[model samples]
Every structure is written in structure tokens, then in C-alpha cells.
Target: MMLPGFPEAAPLAGLAGGLLIGLAAALMLLGAGRVTGVSGIVGRAFGINDSGMSWSSAWTFVIGLPLGAFLVATLKGGFEPEFVPLPLLAVAGVLVGFGARLGSGCTSGHGVCGVSRLSQRSLVATATFMIAGIATVAVMGAL
Candidate 1:
């Protein structure tokens, strides 16, 4: 899909974004000995104790995401994606979040970093999630 204002430079923008994300993940791993898995971090933030680290960084990352997006929007004059109704959005978020937890990782963790490391489990999980997402979108469009 073509982004409205980012038409000509979309591919470059995506590559830059992927590079930045890889750099960030690598740095996080190197510096903190932590996997840059948003679901795991967020689970820890909710007092899930799979690790001993304090939830401070997780909280910061979670909070910073939306704040950073807002700042970028202010700087770039970009429009936000349209949301469904609040109730529907809430339900969808809960289900997706649960799925992420149950699957042991989110898309970024599995698709980008894990797959790059040649992890078999992550490869399967990522492929399953991608197919599921595509099928979901197709079904939704058909409805």
C-alpha cells in the first residue's frame, strides 16, 4: 500500500526503518542482555516475573512509543491511522496481546530478530502469524 505523502520514498523509508530497528535491537541486546521483544517487556511491566530486571525500561519503552509517534506526527504532519470504536479496539487489543503472549513473541521479535538468527521455532511461529494475519485481513475485507 502506498502511503499518501511518502509515495516516492517508501521503499527507502522502509529500509531505513528496518535498519534503525535492527540497530536498536542489537544495541539493546548488547547493552542490556535483553531481547527487544515488546510482548515480553510489556508482560514484565505488568509484574510478570520471568526476569529479574525492574519494569522501568519496559514502562519507558511502552510509554515512549506513542509519545514518539506523536512527536513525529507533529514534525512531519502525518495523519494517524483510523481506529475502530473504542470497545472494538479494546477487545481486539486484548485478543492480539494475549496471542502475542501465548505465542511467546510478537512480530518484531519473531519475524525480524529471531528469524535473522535462524531460530526454527521463531521461523514457524512467524510464518504462522503472517499467514493468520493475511487470512484475517482477507476475511475481514470479504465481510
Candidate 2:
């Protein structure tokens, strides 16, 4: 559904996506006994971190991420994704990777699973992420 001021906002779609993410996180935690942290999974997959998660499992999770998004986008008649230049995108990726490593976890781990479990570190990290995101939007808008 469209939001009042944000005419293109899809609340229903957002809700559905959130639910799916939560469900997936819950399943990962319950079934695999692990947090669905993408960064950690990637690190494990690449042999950068040995968190006891299997390489195959980590690869499966990483591959399923984009595969799931692509399936949904295709079902919805596809979408055009805008991107910054390659150099800028690469820089942003590096920055984000560094931040995630420094923070010990990314948004999915901290904001979703950790927060739900009432972890203090996750709460603070999620708050910090929100503030940073807001500041970034404000700065971009001002430019």
C-alpha cells in the first residue's frame, strides 16, 4: 500500500519482506543454531573467519541471498537498479565491510536477531546504524 507522503512506499510489500527475513533468521537460529549474519557467513565461506560454520553452508546462504531477491524481483516483473560508478561502489563496499568487521556484526545480526533477543550490544549498534543512515540521507539531500 502507498504511504501518505511517500507515494511510492509499499507498506504491505515491506511488511511481507520483513516477515520473510524474520522467519528466515528464526529458522537459521533454531535449525542451524547460528545467527544469520551475512558478514560472518561470508567470512566463514572465504576462510577469513573460522567460526565453526561449514564453508558449504556459508556459500549456500550467500548464494541464496541474491537468488531469493532475484526470484522475487522477477516475479514482480523485474526492477531497474541504479548504481553509483564502479569506483564509488567499490569504495562503499570496502567501507561497509570494514564497518561491519569493526562493529562485530552487520544490520541483520544486530538489528534483527540480536535486538529480538534483547542484546545490549545489538541495540546500541542498531541505534548507531539508524543515526548514521539518517545523517547520510540528510547530507545527501542537502547536496
Candidate 3:
């Protein structure tokens, strides 16, 4: 299951990335009073019509995601994540969108910021998603 062009796992790298994500999310919340939820950001950017951030700002944030990734990949020589078939990826993306709608926010909003704020609803939503994710992995492994 090793991805091409990628070295072995680097827990330090993962930790640094997580820390950076937390810092970014924290900055978005504390600085602009906005949630750093990428799904909502992208949804609004593409005219899904949420009422918080302006299209310009949201679009910038969305564009920054891939651009930042590319920058990191370039700095590190390259990047390769394990590939999934396009059809399955599409289905999974759709399901994730549906779930995000149902849950009111993605992991960034609920899992990081909301949970940090000790929000009861976000706590429940985060737990539900985590459990569902674990169960889904178990079922998939069985399959």
C-alpha cells in the first residue's frame, strides 16, 4: 500500500502538519471570527451560498489549499498519496458532502474549533463522525 515517490511514515512531519492546521484554524476563528471549515468554504466559493465569508475571501482560502500543498510538495521534492479509483473517490466525496451538511460542519469547524470551544453540539457531531469513520473502516476491512 506504499504510495509511489513517498518515503516511510514520518510522525514528526504529521505532527507538524497537525500543529500548523490547528494554528491556522485558531487564527481564522480568533482573528476573523470565522470557522476554518474547508467544505463550507469551497461550497460557498462554488455558489453553494452560505452566509458567512464573502466569495472573494472564501475563494482565496480554497485556492490557498492546493497552492499551499503544491508549495510544500515542491519544497519536499514531490508528494504522493495513496490513490483511489476515481469512481470510488467521487462517491466518497458525495457522501462526505452529504454528511457535512447533515452534521452542520466538517472536522475543522466541529472537531478542531468547536470542540476546542467546548460546544455540546460540535462534541456530539464530532464523536458521531469519528465512530462512523471507525465503523466504516472496520466494515471495509471485512469486505
Pick by lDDT: which candidate is best?
A: 2
Query: In candidate 3, residue 138 scores what lDDT?
Result: 100
Instruction: Show where candidate 2 strays beyond 4 Å.
Output: 1-9
Which tens-of-lDDT digit does each residue in 112-139 have in candidate 3?
Answer: 8889889999999999989988999999
TM-score, predicted candidate 1 vs. hidden true structure: 0.84
lDDT by residue for model 1 (1-143), tens: 87676688779877987898899889878888877887877778888655444688888878887897788778888776886899998998899798887888898888877998899989999999989989999999799
Q: Looking at candidate 1, what is the lDDT of residue 97?
A: 90
Return the clash pairs for model 3, or none: none
Sorted on TM-score, best first, the list reads 2, 1, 3
- Between candidates 1 and 2, name the one with more favorable lDDT: 2
Once fitted onto the true fold, the runs of candidate 1 whose alpha carbons sit more than 4 angstroms away are 1-6, 78-83, 140-143
For each candidate, C-alpha RMSD in Å?
A: 2.5, 2.2, 3.5
Measured by TM-score, how close is model 2 to the native structure?
0.90
TM per candidate comes to: 0.84, 0.90, 0.83
Ranking by lDDT: 2, 3, 1
Which should have the higher TM-score, number 1 or number 2? Answer: 2
For 3-61, candidate 2 gives per-residue lDDT tens digits of 46763647777888999999999999999899888889998998989756899999998
Clashing pairs in 1: none
Candidate lDDT values, in order: 0.83, 0.90, 0.88
| Residue 73 CA displacement from its true place in model 1, Å | 1.6
